[model samples]
Target: MRTDSGLRLEADPRPPRALPPVPSAIQGDTPLSRPKKKKPRTKNTLGSASSEGLAQAPVHRPSEGSELPAKEPAEHPEEAPIQRRQRKTRLPLELETSFTQKKASNSSLLRNENGIHVEPPEEAVTQKPRRKTKKTQPAEIQYANELGVEDEDIITDEQSSPEQQSIFTAPTGISQPVGKVFVEKSRRFQAADRSELIKTTENAEVFVDVKLSWTTRDVALTVHRAFRMIGLFSHGFLAGCAVWNIVFIYVLAGDQLSNLSNLLQQYKTLAYPFQSLLYLLLALSTVSTFDRIDFAKTSVAIRNFLALDPTALASFLYFTALTLSLSQQMTSDRIHLYTPSSVNGSLWAAGVEEQVLQPWIVVNLVVALLVGLSWLFLSYWPGMDLSEELMFSSDVEEYPEKDKGLKASS
Candidate 1:
């Protein structure tokens, strides 16, 4: 194809071009086309040579559609040479055997038959024995025994024969009652004959022939004296009152006893003293007989004394007077004449007087009755004899004498 320009643009001549044929040698010498050189084989280099051979060998790659079996690497021959070298440099046989034996023994010790580990028991070490010493007795008991300061002679069972041992034997006095019976019968007859004659005696005295120490009898005698004084005072006071009443009858126109109120007013002061004396007498009488009285013989006399004694009669008289005074004070208007100042002071004072007088009467009466009952009970109540309780003797041998005296008295 030409353009429209006049110049004739003839078509340029074309030439066919071709590349020279590649030289066969040069083509064969290319990396992809050349054949590899085979390594030289020798005993010392065989291992390395084989390894190179294996690396140069064709690898079988699996296609996308098929799976191929995995290949394992072959063992290298160099391993044997390395093992031989290590063996040549290892420790001696004896050292190796010792190490192995130690390891085996340790394992055996650590693991039991059941595979459980446990601690070993502690070893016990023996020690030398020690000597013992004797113990001494207390000094106080030893001294007392050596000095013969003990209260009674301690006769051992080996020293005293059966006949000589009085520990379990009954007293001789208690065993023989014929003499005691005769004495009691004779005493009863004498008492009967002398009863009327002795009734008028001021003191009702009983004599005991037992040999008692002064120390044992002191308290009893003191109490007896006190009771005697109290009885004397009581009798004296009664006598004085009687004399006063007579004197008053002659002096005051004898009008004091003409009325109940007058008599109570005059005798109120004496009532308390009489009651006190009665109580004191009862106490003294009870205490005096505590150890001296033989209950079996004196039970009846003691009962009579408590029931019909002069002290009891006086207590009853005073109690009656107090009761009469209280009744008159409550019912009679003449009571104000006795203590007008107190009556006019306050209503409370009047009430207090009554309250005080009532309790006084009740207390005195109750106390008197309790004292009498206590004495009676102590004298006659079975198994309640106070003689044994009140005795102050410490010697066991003296008890036989006391028993004899008690038997004679009974």
Candidate 2:
């Protein structure tokens, strides 16, 4: 078109093209900038490939407008048709978070100096809530600074050798619980006080006092060994008593006594006393023995005390009953005896009543009661059990001081 001035200006009559849609500054990320995900790998066989080929391009094609039969889409097929994926939504940070969106809705919009809308940061708030909290200052450090502690005085880790540096030590006693009291490992075992043991090294968990030596462990082991020896001896003694009780019963109750000579018949004297002596021996024995050993219950040796032997109880009860039986039989079944007078008539004579069950049977029963009950009570004594536990804990496996002392000595 020519202008009125006859300046031929051929301008395109079409209106100027509209500018592209302006991108928002608040837009978080573009689809292209977002990380691409890798597809999982899969193996294929010729059969699958051929099946897919046959399914897609069917041998007999359906007539126009007729739908293809329902078939699964190929995982990856050759000569694939072009397909466009729907554009992914890349919402801005402001829109992605519901919290930020709510806040932005509630808060007035902020504008840059250029009068352009600028989205506030996700965490940005118009006003922050004032929280009342006590602000503590290092008063000690400040005091030290006022005192003008020099760099030399403020010793750092680099300033000292490892031997001089403080170590982490747990509190053993009330007197020193606050600071890290680094105690050197005294290759020598004992300290004057229990607190000293704990302060010396942190590994020793128990604090126990001893009578003579700081070597509580050695004392305990020695004690256990002594008890073990005593138990072994007592066990043998008690077993002997039990067996002899049966023999004693056989001699007294049966006719075996008549077969032996008078001097050998003195065996009756030894056997009868052994019945009562069995209880005496058992009283000393059971407490020394251990029923079971368990380290879980205690780091020490035995957790359970030895129980009373059933054989001892049975043997004693049977013997006591036998003595009572003979006494009763002598009283009820004794023969009334008579002797003819030297010159004239028949005269009355002493019979077997006194010979069989004497007044001493009562004494025997009383002694039996005392010994048996005492044995039972001592076997289950809580105090004795407790003492054993304490001893084992202090001395059984490793008393820290004794263990260290031996090592040092060795």
The candidate that wins on TM-score is: 2
lDDT of 2 by residue, 1-410 (tens): 11111100000110010011212211112212222420110011111322332332321123101321122114222211211010101111111112222233433312221223343343122111100000121223222222221221122322223343235422212121222223346674432443443444332222322334457567766777677567546655555555454454445534633432231234334533454465456554544433223223443332232233333343344345345434433222221222222324433222332344234334334434533443444345322433455446644556787888999999
| Candidate 1 ranges with C-alpha deviation above 4 Å | 1-213, 242-410
For residues 76-96, what per-residue lDDT tens digits would candidate 1 score against the true structure?
Answer: 234333322221111111111
The TM-scores, one per candidate, come to: 0.22, 0.23
Taken over the whole model, the C-alpha lDDT of each candidate is: 0.32, 0.32
Q: How well does model 2 score by local distance difference test?
A: 0.32
Clashing pairs in 2: 28-92
lDDT, candidate 1, at 268: 50
Cα distance off (Å), candidate 2, residue 396: 11
Give the poorly placed runs of model 2, Cα more than 4 Å off.
1-214, 255-268, 271-280, 289-391, 394-410
